[model samples]
Target: MPPVLVKGALHFMLVYARDGHVEILKYDLRCSCLSLVDVPLVGPGIHGAAILMAMEDRSLGFAHVDGLTLHIWSREMDFNRVASWSHRTIIDLRNLLPIQNTDERLRLIGSVEGSDTVFVTTDLGIYEINVKSQRWKEIWKSEKFRALIPYMSFYNPQ
Candidate 1:
């Protein structure tokens, strides 16, 4: 629901149709310029199933979950400054999580700053997953569905 900041710009996903076709827009902080970024066509019609994140190298990254599969993409730029998304990683949620029902929905709540960990919410509980290691553990459980937002800030208790 919130834009990710990378390379001095804020990148956000925009759904311009009923079927959930997404477009990424980059807003430059220095020049205040807004431009469209070219990303590969992800699965359509799965509303609220995608999230934009800042990669370790400070580039734009995207994650989308379809059924039991999770897709991750990273943005790349050519010599001429042309931008595109490169499909990077795919993880099977069934093997990663302790899932009982195949029909239970999985939503990517958010990602931890400065790490590859992502928070996923399901009927069972909320789990933190390390995308690189494929390791996960349940962090919280709730009777009703809950959404999580990752936030980071410096504390100065002076």
Candidate 2:
């Protein structure tokens, strides 16, 4: 189960089987309610996925990065009501990332708070990808590094 927090709620990605349909469960902590968010058919090559929120507009973002390409989907979400989100493909990272074949390993780590950028780690380095701008920047690189594990947090100054 892959989980992400969007608009102060928990969204979980539940995959029933390999190469099967995917469903999202939205859990509201305030009311302790869980609702299923229907999703369209997902491709079979999806290996890495992440949920993101655009900081400027607070729109929801979903990314599924396969071995040779990155597929991004986004939609507007209303937290106050039980609304069904409709997503559309926004960008493809094949032009940006150096992917030669389907053997390359890629993983969508997570998104940065207060920004529309999400982090993806490969064998080469860690990259920051902006969903709205369709841009990417390499933040870290190491020849000996085989994988990257990321940690995220929100800081509140009240």
Candidate 3:
């Protein structure tokens, strides 16, 4: 959050609400600097328990961000990460679209091989989240799995 602002340029703010609502606020001290992108309640949310993904996102399975334990998967490589040792504790922070299938399998899945991207797939579709790359860019995704492209992340003015 530390002055991503250019001396006389514009600054952008992306706000996410509890209801999956988002507001993009822009300020340039120049033009209209205001625009709205109404992201209609896109994901699936089960009453009281947690939110799920809509069929639109092609999410196969979703692990509502209410607990720890993560699952990552890579289909092309046919390798899945049931448990990762490098992630440490941040992996426990919270989750959105899940990237593994061990939970759905209920028998605990193992890891895939040679796959760079890892994710999960539900009847709705597939949801994948990158563990290291925080950058937002579209990758060649499969109908088997829809990529959860992140447009914004928290920054500490660094």
Candidate 4:
């Protein structure tokens, strides 16, 4: 998964198939150190995960597939400047897509640079999801691109 920088904090998602656990590694740029983020009980069936920033707030999103339903959960970082996370049910993509097939694989590829929109790739196609509006738009089909990894660039005017 691609890493995201939010408020000078570098975030990386680590997914393990052994227990189907998804954890985040946060590296504080100011302190120049790394710390593991305490994630809530995500349970099993985690397909993919990614970190996104919306309105200056960092959020962790995970995709869980159960049968024919695709569940997405977003966890926002606590505003109290503490090392805590709160989970929120963002959306269920099962009905959003045109095709309704259990064989479709969904993964959180990466987020758009300088935007809250995140890209999710499925076996059928690639979709762009807006974190704030909770809207989805299919950018391209799976045949258009073999990979969905997004490239982000940082520019400092100062």
Best by TM-score: 1
Return the lDDT, model 1, position 47.
Answer: 54
Q: Which pairs of residues have clashing backbones in candidate 1? A: none
Q: List residue ranges in candidate 1 displaced over 4 A.
A: 143-147, 153-158
lDDT for each residue of candidate 3 in 1-158, tens digit (9 for 90 to 100):
11123323333324345654433233556664654322222343321112122112121112223223343321111256332212111243223443344244211111111212233333334444443452222233443422233243457995
| Per-residue lDDT value at 132 in model 2 | 66
Q: What is the descending lDDT order? A: 1, 2, 4, 3
With candidate 3 superimposed using the best TM-score fit, by how many Å does residue 48's alpha carbon deviate from the native?
28
Residues 86-146 of candidate 2: C-alpha lDDT, one tens digit per residue: 5544555667765444465677776764466767776677788776677888887842433
Q: Give the distance in Å from residue 112's predicted Cα in candidate 3 to where it truly belongs.
A: 9.0
Models 1 onward score TM values of 0.87, 0.66, 0.21, 0.67
Deviation in Å, model 1, residue 86 alpha carbon? 1.0
RMSD of 4: 3.9
Clashes of each: 0, 0, 18, 0
Expressed as tens digits, the lDDT of each residue in 20-98 for candidate 1 is 6778888999999999875565557445777778876666888888888888888888999977788989999988888
After aligning candidate 4 to the native by TM-score, how far in Å is the CA of 104 from where it should be?
2.6
* Candidate 2 Cα misplacement greater than 4 A, ranges: 17-20, 47-56, 66-68, 77-89, 98-105, 142-158
